[model samples]
Target: MDLANSGLSGEAVYKSTCIACHGGDGKGAFPGTPDFTKSKGPLSKNDAELLSNMINGFQSPGSPMAMPPRGGNVSLTDADLKAVLGYMRTTFEK
Candidate 1:
């Protein structure tokens, strides 16, 4: 899978990158990490906004925690991050 291109498998990308902070259930690893499974969370943002945050990194406006650029995996492409976000929306944002 060429993660640099379009190998945007949500589950795979989540496992390799996001799971550490976001957790397997998308509940987040710590206080500042947004609970994707929760109704009022990152899912509130649109895809473009979310993608931009994932790529550029995001610091919590109300908290000290932040998601580093590319979730700190730098190796992941925009598509990869998009897929992960899409997957999160589909699976957890309900």
Candidate 2:
């Protein structure tokens, strides 16, 4: 989805891609995955930091479950990633 220009919003992108691992509530589907509802979770990071981690794939120290590069969807563009993150921030950061 060309989210920057396409009518799709951040919530749509997140549902289409991120819901698998992150869950609809952003609580994460499996162990080691971060819980966005928490104050100290990914919501604490800035866009740049989050984007960089997703683009490069994050493997936190002592963690076995890694989030693959582009969150396993290589077709996603930078704008798509940003959109998904925006959804996460607004929906789960409370």
Predicted model with the maximum lDDT = 1
TM-score of each: 0.87, 0.85
Off by over 4 Å in 2: 1-8
Q: What lDDT score belongs to each candidate, Candidate 1 first?
A: 0.82, 0.81
Q: After best superposition, candidate 1 residue 24: deviation in angstroms?
A: 0.7
lDDT of 1 by residue, 30-73 (tens): 77788888676889888888888999999877757778899999
lDDT digits (tens) for residues 1-94 of candidate 2: 2346534567877888788988988998877778889998888988889989978899865567888998898888778787787778879997
Query: Which candidate has the highest TM-score of all?
Result: 1
Alpha carbon lDDT at 93, candidate 1: 86
